[model samples]
Target: MLLDFGCGPGRVAGHAGRALGMRIIGVDASPDMLALAREEGTPGAEYHLVADGRVGGLADACADAAMCNHVLASLPDERTVLEVFTEIHRLLRPGAPFALLTTDPACAGIEYASLRVGEPGVSYGPGEAMPVRLRRTDGTWQSVRNHAWPVETFPPLLEGVGFTDVAQHHPTPDEAVGVADPEHVRSRDWSAERLRPPLVVTTAVKR
Candidate 1:
């Protein structure tokens, strides 16, 4: 079985469950998100609600693989981040893979030339937390407080929680940047700096 931590509206879980043809357990803190997941998710997926970053209802070592997407950024502090990591570790079988995706600390303040979002920017400093504001499709903005940690801080934190062989991946320009039309491409016009991604993806093994 696979576990989707902070599954939100089951966007990933629903697609993954259908594609992989496996049982997927999706857990999130928001009841509204859980409700949406249950309403829209594939048959292979199940939704659960968690409290205080704890998945207390799940059995120990129940999952073969786990994913936490866009979650670390929303954590209020390092303690909560550690708790979530620890809980993920506890839920995975030995040597199971855990994938994490979050806001990239490296490209905190980059302004995209092609992609458009309401005031798309990151606010942070070296060794400091990042706070971000993102605009939804509805044109409303949501604030993500304490959304990112220094890039240097992640390795040690994963190691402390008994994770090994951590690897980070940055999306390429074609993957990160969206093109409205195939024929009317202006990717070449974007500055090299704008190609720097705003998100980071990492994978680690539970030890």
Candidate 2:
């Protein structure tokens, strides 16, 4: 079985299920996202709420693999990452794969990297929330807050949680990939910088 851990809205889970034809399960912390998953997910997909970033609810060695995409960067705390790793290790059989895709803020644009955390807001999950002022080239400001992690620390943390054989995929500089349509091109143009290199993809074995 494949556990799509931190599957938001089940979009990727559905696609991955179709592509791999594997028994799939999904987990998420957001009720709204999970509700959408229930409404739109593939017929056989199973889903459950993570509640507190703990996965004790799942049976041991119940999954063959776990995939966490685009959700690591938003986890509420560092311990939550550890918890997820522990949970994944527990849920998967020996030598099962745990894959993750996460944002590396160090690859952020100069403007984005320069922004300061303005008196960070309430703590959530594994970390605190901080307001960021996006510095626009036109001298205008845009405000948003995102969960941040220091890129240099992830490997050790993953290792600490009983993951081994960890491998990271780094961004390739300007690799040409086809855009199927105009909308796709537009979306790429808008998000490319933020989505490019420094977005780390990692895979580890539960050993």
Judged by lDDT, which candidate is best? 1
Write candidate 2's Cα lDDT for 82-185 as tens digits: 88887778888989998887655554332333243333333233344544465565657787776766555567887887889988876432442441234433
Off by over 4 Å in 1: 113-131, 138-146, 173-194
**Model 2 local distance difference test score:** 0.70
Clashing pairs in 2: 76-125, 76-126, 76-127, 77-126, 77-127
- 59: Cα error in model 1, Å: 0.6
User: What TM-score, to 2 decimals, does candidate 1 have?
Assistant: 0.79
Predict model 1's lDDT versus the native: 0.74
lDDT of 1 at 199: 60
Tens digits of per-residue lDDT for model 1, 1-207:
889999998878877776677789999999999998888847867778888768767898999999998877667567887888899999999999999877666665555443221233644543354556665656576665555565566778888999999988775556533423444344345554346766667889999
Which sections of candidate 2 miss by over 4 Å?
110-143, 172-196
Report, for every candidate in turn, its global Cα lDDT versus the true structure.
Answer: 0.74, 0.70
